[model samples]
Target: MMKKPGSWRQIVWLLIFTLLWGTTPAVGGLFSSLSTEKERELGEEFFLELNNNYPICTDPFVSSYINRLGHKLEAQLPPHPFKYRFYVLDDPSMNAFAVPGGYVFMNSGFIRLMDKEGELAGVLAHEISHIYARHMARMLDESKPVSIATLVGSLAAVLLGGPAAAALLVGSQAAGQAAMLKYSRDHEQEADDLGFKWLQKAGYDPRDMILAFKKLNKQRWYAGGQPPIYLSTHPHTDTRLVELANRLNMHADVLPKDHDNQEFQYFALKVDSLSGSPYQLLRRMTQAAIHEPNNPAYLYGKALALAKMDHPDEAMGALEQGLKLDPGNYFIRREMAIQYFERNRYQQALSLFQRLAQTQPHDETVLYYLGRIYQEQRQFADALSAMERVQSLNPAFVEVYQNLGTLYGEEGQLGLAHYYLGLHSLTSRALPTALFHFRKALVNLPLNDPHYARVKDQIARLEKMKVKVN
Candidate 1:
């Protein structure tokens, strides 16, 4: 039997948050002694490790929307040294976390739970506050010296989750755990206070912060004693709720009542469609479409769920219906093109993708699909051009390097092929494999070849990285 969305989220949350509880002590002062530059360097290292281990949501629309929202909240803050980057992890847990420096992550399930844009903005603002106030560094400054091996082992256990987390906390002292819990609670309170202030400054109602907490609090009841990790780390107390209400009352005359935001609604639907069981999502979206017969968003969501369930014909029909309601909907068009591609309707897919490329020039997903279509049709040059654009727009897209390598290899450019394959391996964190490819590229290319120098430099960098890891 399929797990209900609520149950699924609870289980996933338990696994992910267990890491936070188990590893908090080790993380406390891990980066406190480092300079700002060193802190950022460590953050980059953490980000890379996560990308290698976890499934990060690379959907262009989802990532861009979340980043834009994060930056809007960030704009209301005073100048800070670190550059902020927002990411949506592919996990279905109801939690968000901020690491040292300015890296913030939100789970896909958590985004789906939000009803208003301000609720999400409030969450992001709270995370930003943790980074802005240097809470991690401060906490670490007061912590005792812990072995580096123990710290690494604890973090790995958390990331591994499930049975590993249980084993990690098997012998943890109760006093140490209690102290870490108190420390976490204190940080949560400070984040909430500062986040509320920033949310108001950014022209979002401060009450939305209260609403966000209320929603999480309600989830705690649904989960009984095993509440989601967000609640565990940031306990929702009566006093906290009362304080937030009082703060909002002070600005009641100036604050506007929360209303539905179309962007939030659309993105929430998208996240839900992407994360939930296909059959269940299709059932839910089907009912939603029937109730609001003219709503394109519902139809679009239904189309995606249908596609997920391997009902291509039904998915295409739904997209066509949605297009009739909103012909200019970029999302609907993109879905239609994807469906066409899946059905081997090459010309139809190519036509739609080309049109979309003209309108959404910087849309990485659009360009990526366009490249795929071109590749399938044996238009290697066009495919290479499209992929190059995608690479320039988002280097974090690991697939572009893979595709580029394949295309170059097909075109009899062995040196270039090896070089790109090396890059693909590097981005995927297969350092030794990447070094091998880089070496092969250098061996194949003539000494005077322009790329020979580049490949040599890459080889040197990878070797240094391997040394540092050792």
Candidate 2:
């Protein structure tokens, strides 16, 4: 069972934010008719708070997958004001939520619960619709003047399974919270309609959303001893599901349903493996493997669960058995190579990754892992070469930035090192650290370098956030 949050927690958060911002959140006014700029600014502050307080999943592959899938759906929509960013929250809550500025977060547990890529797409599409519709701003516009701190406290309360939101629902503030809830429900319906259209438009099955809702609403928290936070935030109603099902008749004859996605297994397994409670995951995957003896994903998931549980040798044993079953499985092979590296069996890892890289030169995972192996062996030149290649292949590979910074620093390239480190911090949303490193980069980088200009632009943005270089 989840612990109910005390009133003090909400009060503390409200007090802290009030002190930081020097006023209560004029929730109704500040965002009432919030311009795009103001919404973005608000989102920036909230996201910064979230990043500082929550544990964001940092697995390069997992992070990249969520962003890729999110942006893929985002591209289906017409041009928008904000650049969409997706993050995986490192929590076991079966919940997903969107912040104002085109930022959507999928909890690791939520992502793990999803069985199909289309289902995941459905979830993303819904969140995307919410952002595109500016529902938060609209809700504020509709609400009676409420403090921003009250909104934050309410959110904090909901997160804690506390009473602030429930408390607000029935008092002098009842009308405001009641109105907010009504809007929330209405917004969910609108998002479902829009998300259905967009998901189908983006070549995913519209029915996936219905399936996802039923699947989630019917589920108990798999980690056990935890409440269904998804229900608290996004209660999937029978009526809502019925309406969605009936609405599907309108698009009955749409051609060529796009339902299959090869990436789902790897993506789901990755999230499940990194879950907070690996013991539960291990047992789950182990039973799954027993049922489907040849399912590579289950075997792979089981090994990863073991690895996460600190049973490296057992994980290696499981992987070796899995590899024997399916020698050609790329996911399994890549994982085996990763295990080798983790255990300091660098030669084996290097050999395996090199061969994998030969076949997959454009694969960021293979290239990134190869680069790390090379860096570990003191092959600085090779490491830099591989890391640089990875960067050229996918500049958004955030881990590559940090590794490149380390490699370049080892090569005595301080300017490039600082620049890459700055890039890493910037992407990680560590504004102060980003500002510090970007300033250091400016001192050492030539004025004419393209990176110098990039660094300056980023520094200016950070400064706008009150993050000074000095």
Give Cα-based local distance difference scores for all models: 0.70, 0.71
TM-score of each: 0.77, 0.79
TM-score of the candidate numbered 2? 0.79
In terms of lDDT, which candidate is strongest? 2
Indicate the TM-score of model 1: 0.77
Q: Which ten residues in a row have the lowest lDDT in candidate 1?
A: 1-10
RMSD of 2: 5.5
Clashing pairs in 1: 28-140, 29-140
Regions more than 4 Å wrong, model 1: 1-32, 145-164, 170-186, 201-203, 253-260, 375-423, 437-470
